[model samples]
Each structure stands twice: as C-alpha cells, then as structure tokens.
Target: MARKMLIDGEVAAVADGGHYDYDLFVIGAGSGGVRGSRTAASFGAKVAICELPFHPISSEWLGGHGGTCVIRGCVPKKILVYGASFRGEFEDSKNFGWEINGDINFNWKTLLENKTKEIVRLNGVYQRILTSAGVTMIEGAGSLVDAHTVEVSQPDGSKQRYTAKHILIATGSRAQRVNIPGKDLAITSDEALSLEELPKRAVILGGGYIAVEFASIWRGMGAEVDLFYRRDLPLRFVINFRESLLLLIL
Candidate 1:
C-alpha cells in the first residue's frame, strides 16, 4: 500500500510511510542545500543534510561547508585581494603626511595562515547554524537511489540509506580547466586561494571577472601579470583595455 503525505505544500506518495527515515533529505551542504534544508526544517519538516568532509581545496570526495561562494570562490579570493590592497594603502598614506620607513614587504605565509584560520572558523560556524536549526548534518556524499531514497557514502567507504518524502540536490559547480597542453601544471582558483608562496610572475588565462580580479590582485602585490583573452575586448567589452586602470598609480 502506498502512503501519502504533505510536503512543501504538495502531496507526495511513499511506498512505506512508517519505514521512512526523514521528511526531507538534502544533498550537498552548499549555500543552496543549507538554505533549503533550514527552510524545510523551519516549516516543521524533518530534514537531513549530507556533505563531504571539510577541505579548502575541494574534489569529488572532499568539500567544505558553505559551498564554493563561501569557501573557495568569493570569501578566500576577497581576503587575498584585501591583503594585496594594503600595498596601495601604505603607499597612499605617505602622500597624506604619514611618514613610512623601511621597505614594506608582504608576507605570503602570514596572510595564508590567517585566511585559513578564518575559513576554518567559518566552517564551524556553519555547522553550529545547522545544529541550531535542528537539521541532521551527515558528513558524506549523497546519491539518489530512487525517487524517495538517498544513499550517503561516508569517508570510510560505508554507506547509509535514508528514505524521505522530498529530496533536494544542490552539490554546486566545479571549476573547469581549459583542455590545453600541460593543463595539469596549471592551478585552479581553489588552489590559488591557499597558495603557500606568491609567484614572482603569473600568466592568467581568460577575460572574465575572475581572471581580471586575480590579475589585479597579483599586480597589486607586486607581481608581473599577463592576462590572455580570446575576445577583442577584455571583461566582456564593458571596459576598454587601456583605460581599464589595473595599475594603481600612487
């Protein structure tokens, strides 16, 4: 006999009502999954969210909380940019009657360590948020076995099956590299955020916002940056090449 229940303002039929584990099972703990699960739980639905182990550099088996935008995408990138921007600030302060003495050197190790500490702290904060929301947080990868069944694989290769009336998939997206020769030697944005040392020279590919942002970041930190783009104009033709004003003239 099929059992029916109301979920998210909709009626859903289940094969076994008494045997089901949760009302809502969410895959991926990224922003979407977290928001969806929290919302569902707020509506009095039993929710369980699954995600991989915490890692700054993500892969199929390891992804931290808060997904790409919070973890590797925006948060870390902005931190680096802010750290690099200090160079301009220090130089500008000299013109404002602030006497600057000695060579102003940026320490890559110190910045990387502090950024990592902040990220790890935020990861714990996200977990606490889920705990407070009453959502079950399972550390693993989730896959759909059926319309109402989800299979979660833990880090130790063990798996658990949970049946829910509704399931949400929000694993998020991964960065793709250009299929060129020696592509493996190139690093993606994820690795760029946690680099141990700043490179003296950097050649960035693409003409998008990310590429331009990184070029500015490195250039601000005193690196020789060369950006390559296929389009006639950089940044989708919104900003001209010469008048882009990447270099900070202090």
Candidate 2:
C-alpha cells in the first residue's frame, strides 16, 4: 500500500492503501539524495528517504537527517566562512574612514547562538521542502537487505522493509575525526561553528578548510594561532609530482 502525502498546494501519494512500493528510495538526506528525491517527486514519482540517527560524526549507521554535509560538514563550514568574512567587512569599514571607538573585542557567543538558531531553522525548512514535495522522510539507518529491498532501523528500534524501483545513496564524506588523548575534547567544525568563546590561543591540527578558516577567524579576532598541516606545504595551490602514476578504485 502506498502512503498519501501533500506537497506545496498539490498532492503526491506513496501509499494510499496498505504497504506500498516506492518509485524511488533514497538513503541519506544529504544534498544529493534530497535534491534527487525532490526532483523525482516533482516529476510525479513516489519517493522515500531514510536518514540515520544524529551524531557529531556522520556514518552509515550513526548519521542524522540532512546527512553529514548538512549536520556536520558543508553547513558548518560555510557558517565559519560567514563568520570569518566579518573581518574583511571591518577592514572595509575602517578604509571608509568610519573610525569610531575603543578596542573591539570579539564576542564568539553571539555568532554561536545565531548559528545554532539558523541550523535548526534550516533543518525545519528541509523537512518542509520534503513534505511539501510529497516525499517520504524516513528517520533511520537504511541497509540493503536484498536485491531491490531495503531495511531501515528506525530511531524507536523498529524495523521497516521497503521495495523500490530505484535507490539512491548520498551520505557524503565524513571528516577524519581522530582518536587520541583529549581527542574527544577537541572540537570538530560542527562545534567550531558555535564556539562559546574565541580562545586567546588556538592550535589547528589539519590541512582541511575548516582548520584554515578557524585560523583566519581566530587571528582576525586577535587570537594567537598555530596551524599544523601534515604535508610540508599548505593545501592551497600546492602541487606534487610523484613517481606512481596509477591509482584507481575499480
């Protein structure tokens, strides 16, 4: 039996009767999966999506709605970009001869609060977009039970089985969150986006965009910053010529 759902002012149905089949089944709610599902739904296909449980780190079994990119990666990273961009704005303000006051201290809490609020708001908007598109948003981790069949472990510990004409997986990549002493204490970009305070000193530990952006942000806000990258050269515009000429997954 297919379910019935409404999108925008129109209506789309997945199962109007009993247990129903879907034209498309999506695993993970990242940008690609959701976008594909929505586009398919818009074309009058019955679509369903399964999202894993939420965690600071993303994985097939321990992911959340909006996938890694939304909950932990792209969204958070872009927010940091927005935060870092304020420095340029302030510089421009100075160039415009808007010299006004005393020492301007950085307030990390304000941006953090607003970031949290915006993420929540975007999450809701994502949900609404799916619902309005008549796409089924399943909350759980999906597994390939058999050919053409997918089994989902829901948040409440229940299991659901679905058969679909097509299945899409778009979980996106996870950060290389390391494990070591105080590793758990270290903040990923997810938390960095909502930092409570701009530390007087910061030691960045990766060659990734998140690390570099934080370095820029903290330094811009008058914090001492030490950036450490594994490679001899920084990631930006660096090229290497190695002897090995072959690398293929297949």
Candidate 3:
C-alpha cells in the first residue's frame, strides 16, 4: 500500500499487534470533538476525527469544517452583527458631536458577501488547527458500525471502518426553523446571516437571546421590526419599577 510521508490520516503504519492504531475515534469534527481528539493525541494517544464537507448553510446534511461556529453559526452571525452594528455606531457618532455624513446606507448584499468570505476563511483556519495538531482529520460522516468501531461514509460513497478504544460525539448544536405552513419563507439565524435583501417588514417571534439580538439588529438596520414574545410587558404599569429593571422585553 502506498501512503504519503506527510499523511495524517486513518491509514496508519500497521503494527503486528495493531493495538496502537487509534486510541480514540472522534465521531464528529465539531468544537468539542476536534478538541478532544487533539488533546488525546497530544498526550501520546492515537486519534482520528471525521467531518462532513464545507457548507455555507449548515444542516444535518452539509455541515462543514470548523463545525457550526465557522460554517453557519458564530462566525457568520457575528460578522453580520458587526456589519449591522455599524448603523448604530454611526448614529452614536452623530450624538458624540462628530459631523457624520447624511443617511448612511446599509447594504445587506455587500455585508452578506463579506461575511461569507470571512466565514470560509475561518473554516480553513480551523482545518489547519486540527491538521497541525497531528490529529488525523477524516473528511466524512461517521456512524456506529459496532460498539468500539465506526463506519465512515466518504464523499464518493466509499465506506471504511475505524476501530478505537474510545469513541466520542461532538457534533454541536444546529439552528432549527419554526414548523409552520409558511416556514419555508422564513430563514433561521444561520441563513439570516447570508440574506440577499434586507427585510422591509421583519417579524420575529420568540423570547430567546437570538430572537432579541436579531430584532435589535434588524431594527438598527432600518427594518420595520415587529417583535412578539409569549408575554408582553407594560411600561406605565410599574409597581416600584426601579427594583429590577426588566424593561422592553419584547
């Protein structure tokens, strides 16, 4: 069998005992999975970690390198948020006695374009982190073939089994869209970061931090935001309001 000298992959130097093949097999190449693999490898434990192809919009199917953070979650979300926050920063600059220009326009397409590029860059960086750590990085989805063994499905429909003393799952959380009739029209926080056009009338429903933050962001970007929560707060009906200032919940 021909193997590259610099190959940090599953095909290892076969030993007579094959006991040192892999001490750990990380099922998902997400944050916790990759971290665990690298840490174990660093401490003289053999490791192999697998992940799906790079995806701009991550689902269960097409999740990419760097896990949810780079492909669809934190990296893209933060980039868009940073891009959107400038609108407010511009407003605050005017109040700070700075002679800012008139009617600063927020280009959703441009911000989305830049965010996509930044997210891809971060994905590559994460790949480097895993590879440079001497942890064998496999590109595919892993399944439990047995108790101590896993079957990895490659991009070309090829299957290979890996055995390890320990198996780990680190596939991070995924964003879920609402299950309604018109749910297809609405995008989750993941797809929202890559919107082609700014929503003219944005309606957000939920009491979570993502919902609140997105509402604030869209409002800042000049969208007519109608935010709804399960419970509504009354401003004027204050029974000693200064005690715990829970203001403007929705």
Give the winner by lDDT.
Answer: 1
lDDT of 2 by residue, 60-118 (tens): 46666565566666776667667767777887898899895886655677776666666
Tens digits of per-residue lDDT, candidate 3, 186-241, equal 87887777677888888886756577668767887888987676555322244356
**lDDT tens digits, residue span 66-109, model 1:** 89988898888899889889989998998899998887777999
Most TM-score-accurate candidate: 1
lDDT, residue 155, model 2: 54
Model 3 residue pairs with clashes? none
Q: Which of 2 and 3 is the better model by TM-score? A: 3
Work out how many backbone clashes candidate 1 has: 0
Order of models, best TM-score first? 1, 3, 2
Against the hidden true structure, what lDDT does model 1 obtain? 0.84
Give candidate 1's TM-score.
Answer: 0.90
Task: Give the C-alpha lDDT of model 3.
Answer: 0.72
RMSD for each of the candidates: 3.7, 8.1, 6.4
**Model 3 spans > 4 angstroms off:** 1-21, 233-250
Q: Model 3: what TM-score? A: 0.80
